[model samples]
Target: MATIAIVYHSGYGHTAKVAEHVRSGLEAAGAQAKLYTVDAFVDAETGPWDELAAADGIIFGSPTYMGSTSAAMAKFLELTSKAWFTDGWKDKIAAGFTTSGSLAGDKNETLQRFATLASQHAMIWVNFGAKPGYSMSNSDFATVLNRAGHFLGLATQSLNDLPPEQAPDAADLQTAEVFGQRVAEATKRWVRGAA
Candidate 1:
């Protein structure tokens, strides 16, 4: 069985919710999956980097802050420089997701940044393959092409003062799950072809 690692940082649990859905999707697809929160890496005796290096696929998530990823996630990426030097993630399937507080939040930028980092490590990138809803669909609230990125893109409407727990509705969670399943399926294909 292939292994998939979901690594992310959640400022107020919104991104964490997305990460959980992603993890569920991967597990449901028959892969050995694990969720690693950036918070744990700060002081944990052993971080998830080892697992990440060994996994066949990796998914990254982070909350958008000031048009980018959380500082914690950024730091995590910076730390991966060591792994990059050693080509630890070469040939892995990589994807990214992000959540922001508003429609105009720079969530896409965050995902793009992660995708670029993945490319730097010579990894294959995956994008959300779900068909886009018509512009009139209530779920299609964001602007056209709003979700564009190397991999699955998700947005939540967190109106002022509303927390992510109450902001991202069922639709957002469902999208995340599908994204995860797609990645797992793609990873399986890659592994089979490699063998």
Candidate 2:
């Protein structure tokens, strides 16, 4: 079975909710997916570094803050220096997800950071294949597809004013679920082909 590690930092639990939806898709796709919070790892308490190292694929996630990734995600990325130097994640499959307040809160920048980091590690980047959902026109009601229309990675939107528990919305989380399933299937194909 393929193993996927979800390393993320959710400042207000919105991202965490998205992560679970991703896990649902991953599990449905037949891969075992695990979640690792960057904060937990920071305290030297939780997180399975070994699982991360052994994972067939890794999905990086974080909230977009100040037109970039969150500080916690930044710190987590910084901690990967040892792995980067050793090419620990070389050739592994990598994807990214991000949550932001505005419909377009420069969340693409956050996804770009993840892709850049994957490139530096010599990892393969997975692109989001969904089209933009519900444009400026509310009558469109385009929500089943990629809501943000990000081709590089998954970009989810959450209302900043609402509670984190109810903000990501069903549509945003469903988009994430599709992204997760896509990655899982891709990983399975790559693994089986290599075998």
Candidate 3:
């Protein structure tokens, strides 16, 4: 079976919710999904390096802090240079997701940065395929990328101080689920073709 590892950092549990939705979607798509918090590796005591190395796909997630991923998640990305140098993740499928406080808080930039890191590792990228869900009345909350994004991007919004439970909303989770399934389905096709 294919395995997809979701590695992320959620400062206030918002990103974590998105990760879980993605994981659930992957599982539904017939792949084993594993969730790894950045703290699991950054804590200096508990790390899941081997688990990460064995995955068929990797999805990175984090809250958008100051227009980028959290410092902790960034550090985790930095530490993956060893794997990159060895080309350990060269052919794996990669995707990214981010949650932010505002409607236009540079969330796309954060997702793009994550995608760049994945590209540097020589991995294939996937993106959310949903159209922007905008209405004339609520254009501010509307997104061009919708729940699914473009080129392996997933964007979510959590209004100020409202927990992820309220921000990402059901629509965001639904989008995440679709993204997960798409990634897993693509990975399966690639693996079968390779064989």
Candidate 4:
């Protein structure tokens, strides 16, 4: 079975919701999924490197702040420099998801940062891979699974001041769930091929 690690930093808890949906999807797809909060790792003793090294895929998530990933996520990335040198994450499937306050919060920048990080580690990046559920002219964002129609990665827009428990909406969360499942399926195939 393929194992995926969902690592994220959620400032206002919005990103955490998204990460959980991804985990659900992974588990539903029969792949083992582990959740690792960056802040938790920093505050406690989490041997994240060992988990990451054993994972067949890694899904990174964070909330967009100042048009980029929060400093917390950035710090986590920086801490992985040792893994970079050792290529500990090399060949692992990688994907990213991000939540922002605005519909278009330059969230792509954050996803691109994820892609770049994955590339530097010689890992393969996976796209969101779901068909768009609505057109631009549609007014019901709630009906579309991928409301933002993101192609590179999953992008979710949550209200700026609202609590995450009420923000991601059913559609965005469902999209994340599907995105997670896709990554798991891809990782399963990748691992089988590697073996």
Report the number of the highest-TM-score candidate: 4
Among the numbered candidates, top lDDT falls to 4
lDDT of 4 by residue, 33-63 (tens): 9999886556323556787888899999999
Ranking by TM-score: 4, 2, 3, 1
C-alpha TM-scores of all predictions: 0.87, 0.92, 0.89, 0.94
Candidate 4 wrongly placed segments (more than 4 Å): 43-46, 136-138
Error of 2 at 59 (Å): 0.3
- Residues 1-195 of candidate 1 have per-residue lDDT tens digits of 988888899878888888888888888887778899886675333576677888998888898898988999998888888788889899999998888777657677887898899999999988887655434554454433323232345544455576766756666666677788888999999999999
Summarize candidate 3's per-residue lDDT along 1-195 as a digit string, tens digits. Answer: 888999999988889998999998899999889898888886433488778788888999998999888999999998888788789899998989988887668898789888899999999888776566665655644333363333448887777778765868777777788778888898888777878
In candidate 2, position 24 carries an lDDT of: 88
Q: In model 3, which runs have C-alpha deviations exceeding 4 angstroms?
A: 43-46, 135-152
Q: Relative to the true structure, how large is the alpha-carbon lDDT of every model?
A: 0.77, 0.86, 0.82, 0.89
Model 2 lDDT per residue over 123-172, tens place = 98998877676556653433556767788998888888988778788788
Candidate 3 vs 4: which has more lDDT: 4
Model 1 CA lDDT for position 109? 87
> Model 1, residue 133: displacement in angstroms?
1.5
Global CA lDDT computed for model 4: 0.89
TM-score of 2: 0.92
Score candidate 2 by lDDT.
0.86
Better of 3 and 4 by TM-score: 4
Q: Candidate 1: lDDT over CA atoms?
A: 0.77
